[model samples]
Target: MTGGSAGAAAGAPWAEFGRRLRSLRRAAGLTQLQLGLRVGYHHSAVSKLEAGLREPPVGLVRRLDAVLETDGELAAILAEPREVPRRTGRFPADP
Candidate 1:
């Protein structure tokens, strides 16, 4: 992939993921308290996740997907780790 594409594919950080979660919740017309009740978490937990203070766990992601009827996008996003390029060889300056 081109550098730009590769970077884009690297998966979003926790903060962006949180924002997406919050947006999805809002689009579903659910408040944090209501969403948290559906997902079996506290309201503060949902708030922290939406605020980017905590990353959602896999179970939470799955619950969110089901609750929002997102057809698994949220679950898929949570499954991937942030991608990074692998180093193939030592630097030329290495002895």
Candidate 2:
């Protein structure tokens, strides 16, 4: 949240990233609490990340990429989400 990147951070890509996270989490049959436990975060934190209301810490994103077995896809989104092709099939539809 440093460098005035707070409010300015949530864009189309950010929202997409959230959807992607939710999709991945669901596909793995993981509740927010389950993923949070695996990632050293709280369930509320996961909720915020999926809601695009907060930016994920880089380390956390990396951990998520690993824990979710997304193969760096989550980190890739943060790195260049705009280039990520949206694929609802690849990700379960968010409820």
Candidate 3:
């Protein structure tokens, strides 16, 4: 994986992380809507996050860890090296 297409290839990790988040949410018996509500985001936000179309905000990730009862799992995922807004345009705003 190199050059132009390498960009897409690089997304695999985040995509997989999204999958894990989906599984965790489901195991907790929460729908995307439910999770989003808990995290103060729209259901579509959850969908995009789960679909890897957007990067999870750091705060959202922490909220999810609490909402989904993952006890830091989601936050741990956020800590991993991944492209931020510079490349993905989905980073959390500075606060």
**Candidate ordering by TM-score (highest first):** 2, 3, 1
What are the TM-scores, per candidate, against the unseen true structure?
0.69, 0.71, 0.70
Whole-model lDDT per candidate: 0.79, 0.83, 0.79
lDDT (tens digit, per residue) of candidate 1 on 1-95: 25664355335366666777889999999999999999999999997776666768888888899999999988777677776678979676756
Best by lDDT: 2
Those runs of model 3 whose alpha carbons end farther than 4 Å from true positions after fitting are 1-13, 82-95
Window of ten residues with lowest summed lDDT in model 2? 1-10
* Clash count per candidate: 0, 0, 0
User: Which candidate, 1 or 2, has the higher TM-score?
Assistant: 2
- Model 2 lDDT tens row, 51-86: 777778999999999999989998888887256565
Candidate 2 backbone clash number = 0
Sorting all predicted structures by lDDT, with the top scorer first, yields 2, 1, 3
Name every residue pair that clashes in candidate 2. none
lDDT of 3 by residue, 12-89 (tens): 556766778889988999999988888899999987777666777888888888888888987887677866545666
